[model samples]
Target: MQAMENGGDLPRRIGVYTVERELGAGGMGTVYLARSRGGRAVAVKVARPELAADPHFRARFRAEVEAARRVGGFHTAPVVDADPDAQAPWLATAYIPGPTLAELIERQGTMNKEQLRSLGAALAEALQAVHACGLVHRDLKPGNIIMADDGPRVLDFGIARAVESTRLTATGAAFGTPGYLAPEQAQGDEVGAAADVFALGAVLVAAAGGSAFGTGTPMGLMYRSVHEPADLSALPGELRSLVASCLSKDPAGRPTPETLLGSLGPDPNPSPDPKTLALATADRPHVAPPVPVEPPADHGRVDEPLRRAPAELSRTPRVMILLIAAAAVASALVGGFLALTRHGDDNKGGGPSVTASDSRRATSQASTPPSTPASSRVAAAPKDRVTVVVTAKSGRSWISAKDHNGQILFDGVLDNGETKNFTDKSQITLVLGDASLLQLVVNGKEVPNDFQPGQVERLTYDRSGEMY
Candidate 1:
């Protein structure tokens, strides 16, 4: 149901709920924050226009919604209402305000060991509940898990399948995110509970550190999932073996959700106190503000003249003094900015590092040049600062460029013909989508690129123009 508004397009109502605002949108549809007639807050996911017109998709959606309703409320958000037959089908669930796991990690960084364990255990339990209802959550990833004040809540079973279904599955379709998809899923094989477990393993790795398979094109990630072992080197020693088991290439070898739950052991971070829990439940927080980037501190040079240099010095050659002062100020600003952008500082030496000890191993990689080739290396310049420029040539691409300090210099889509520049003193990491569509220039030298469209690529560079 759509209620007309006075001006531009606005959906005042959807079914019985009054639309408040859009929470988010995805391939399937947009989810709106709405209030029921009874004054209860809810999240209403309205199907996309095209999806609503597809009878097959509507049937699947309706079945999934019914299954979602059957999911136990213990570790999952319960479906409150839905209307699949409506003009634009929609489903509503109790609104819980919190950041999704993906959002949390992006803003607050990776979770501690105990936090990761809690997350894994909670998700496994949720899957157990979901599976007990004879449903397999075919799509389980960080974006689908909400870190509520009470505990983690699993969400979005939009593509869940009933265990007893005999219809041919659409395994070949690129339905889920690449890195998180199971090997079987990537191969277009029948996905079962083990598939969810595989996704769980990927999620745990992402929560604890970063993507286990690393970033690449979806097809590349899929190939890795089918052929290579998960990289759990970043996981704590205590969890390596267990997480490894969950990521086993063979479905039969993977642990069931119930077994995985037991393996998580005791909660490392216990629940809040009764009073705290009461308060949390009584008045829930709606959203968590993104972590703020620390702005560069003022060097106080902007007012240095007022503090130092006596008034009598003002009689000196004004132009000469001004030129000298300006040069000094410029040099100081550039150096400070470079130092602040160094990535390894705030990490306190915790992340992957390209140290002297690993230089031999790094150089041994045949595909990646340990150092810029003599033919490709940038000519020696006056300053040692590293510089990078990316120009989108034929197609739009997504980009995330970060300095050593983990500060995002740019993170968004880049349209064709657009260009972006970045600089850093120590190192910079770039995550690029459709790498083939962009030309890369490092320190004024162009690097050879044969990347293809729709592929993801991650590149790290140091001040010396060395690739890591």
Candidate 2:
């Protein structure tokens, strides 16, 4: 299960989705609740920056995403998008609309015999689909199961092997939750489909009652899984036999998901109502994080004035000082008279006379050109500047952007996490080499577009206009 964390610093855009916030992070990477360009909500799982550097890890992660994509079953969260070769490889899946089984059990207590039966059947069916795709859901603990409206749905199938093979076992230790790992997995043996069945059995025990092996240190749990018999006394009378068969020490003795479904008979409950499930799974009330306090601005360092005091005033004799003051006064009077004459001539006809304007222009050209006025400089600065942040997630993509006036702002290759922010007035248009490789953000909102891999796209957006 991914550990929940405050997602305060999570990027506003990842891939093509706008990240709402982080849901959690495990040994693998952070999971974010994000929305697609088409307004579809999805759970985006991103690999950690460090892990993305490992070539072996990237290969395994890509394989996991591909394998998960091939599995077709209503019982699993379907992969909506993915880019494993990205700087921070990520996968997006349809957001399940319910709480995890673990959360459900924690809040409402264990499921009754009937609920357990339904859950067992659904998960087994999901496993069948996974195995058929030549993959194994290495991590199938209660946390990975969501009790959706229709039934239980499995999640996090993408990159399961990457997490198991790289992050968790980096210290030469085994991966997976100790209590839920199959005996074969704990023994460091190569796993097969039956390994998932063993995990399902453990899940059943928790659903029917609680952890069968109880709690202990990692080593203790590993010891019990390999040597001790599971304490299954709390399991309901009817499910004990089937659950035990699944928890058998030998993998061959375990029942496949299909066989387990048959053993459970039939689904007894109608699909849960979507509205009810949504309400039940609504985010729990949480204390809003305290607003950060900003440091006070420094006001002591003032800019030096451009003009300097006349040094001659301090050193000149008293007589010379009076002479200098008189001379300065005379010069100011003459300058003011000249300014009045120019202004009167300029306003003779309620507008500047052509001769006056020409004379002013000639004077201006005769001296060094006046510095650009602050007002004019501000106008010259970009306006309606739509900041477009483009990040490359996979292979290199040709990225070019233009302002509403058709002026190109950016033209270059972008690859995995490589980002460029552009500013323009009115609107911005983007031309992408491959839709899937580029994630777009204009101003602060994510641009919605489902550009297929290797497909070129030309999209335009404005401050007030929707992306097109």
Candidate 3:
């Protein structure tokens, strides 16, 4: 049911539970922290009044309760209470004390190999539970996973209408985060386990420290999910194909969540005691496996911020390359953002391309560029930050321009198949293939982007419509 008021907090005690605090709000409702009569902490979700009046929504919620009830996994937050018939129907589940995975990724850019492997394993395990029960967690995204001390826990089942439910979903009703949604879901195909896997693929990109779908706003990502090839350029080699398997558009081509876990190595970060972690963080903490990351043992890896650079700068496949060569010779500050990861800057700038090592070097080295000479500062305010984007498909990298914020200054590919940077704040978004997300790099550090561009490099895909 919808909250009685728009943008207003929900009322306490819908029936027997008491609302404690507002957790979050959505277009249809607000999620709250509440307590049941048994003194258990519960996450109570109340719908907006408008939605409550819709019989279709009510039927969906009623069936959702049953579908969610079938879920059984250590990685899932168990549902404990509900009142599908209340005037403002609501469902309550045990309160999961932790920040969402989305929160953790924003705080810490991509996870090193070990962390990615750990995440893949845990999430795969969680999905296995969901799949086994014959229930699909239609909504799976970074924001949906809670990083508890134990492991990543999946949440939110309100939008999940059981397949067996006789009630039809409201016309044009679509659920789940845009970038993370599968292609089939976008096309309004009846979904099942595969849809969730596609979402898992996007989630992994985010977990590994890349944008969910390159760049652009949430809406842009949704558009990309529907029509473009995925940008998995930042993905580590061992796991890239694994993620690809999950993203397969053909439902039969994708792996069951359980099968997905089989591809990842064992978990290195042992789950900690939730009680102890809760005591330490005070507030609900969304825990990560720990950072200053180390890659998995199979791969020769070292500290993340201090590791040796990859052999080549990561690149999008194709004849399209960014004018990195031209940019390097023209300006001292080629990339954007701050935080040096390497020693003295590479003034020569003539580095090898296509290798991950070089990309690492660029990130590490440019990250530590020496102070800018006072003479050249004024002429290039817009070019103050350089952005680099890598993509899964092939493409000729290009450059455009954007203002200080994320507004588009220009849009086109500047170069093809090479490493480069820009100083202009005309925020450059690397468009990989015909995708919605523009692989974005602000001043160098990987950052999320809206559709508004600075400048952008075009990505070319060897193949397209990659999902299956």
Q: How do the predictions measure up, each by TM-score?
A: 0.56, 0.54, 0.54
The candidate maximizing TM-score is: 1
- Give one digit per residue, the lDDT tens place, for model 1 in 21-65: 888875456888999888999989887675666676677777888
Q: Candidate 1, clashing residue pairs?
A: 217-456, 342-405, 343-404, 343-405
**Which regions of candidate 3 fall more than 4 Å away from where they truly are?**
1-10, 162-173, 217-219, 267-468
Q: Model 2 over residues 1-468: C-alpha lDDT tens digits?
A: 222255546677877788887787765778999999999999998877767777777888888888888988979999989987777888899998788998898899988767788788889999999999989887788888888989999987645567655423221122566677764455444577777888898898888766756664443354345434566666666677788788766666678888998888664544566676666656744533234343332112211111212232122111011111222534332111000011111111132433443333211001111232212222333435655666665655545555665443443344344555555666766645455676676666665646554443446666653563
lDDT of 3 by residue, 1-468 (tens): 334445665574566777777888653457888877778888887766656676767787787787778787789888887777788777777888998998988886668767888888888888888778767777787877899998889887435442212111221123455567664454333466777888888888888766545554333454345433465666776677778777654556677766767667664444556766667776645654333343342212111211112212212221122333224655564443221111111212221232322243222112223243222322333433343433212333223232233233222332222232334323332222222233433333333433222121222111111111
Clashes of 2: 1
Q: Which 10 consecutive residues of model 2 have the lowest summed lDDT?
A: 335-344
Top of the candidates by lDDT: 1
Model 1 vs. true fold: TM: 0.56
Ranking of candidates on TM-score, top first: 1, 2, 3
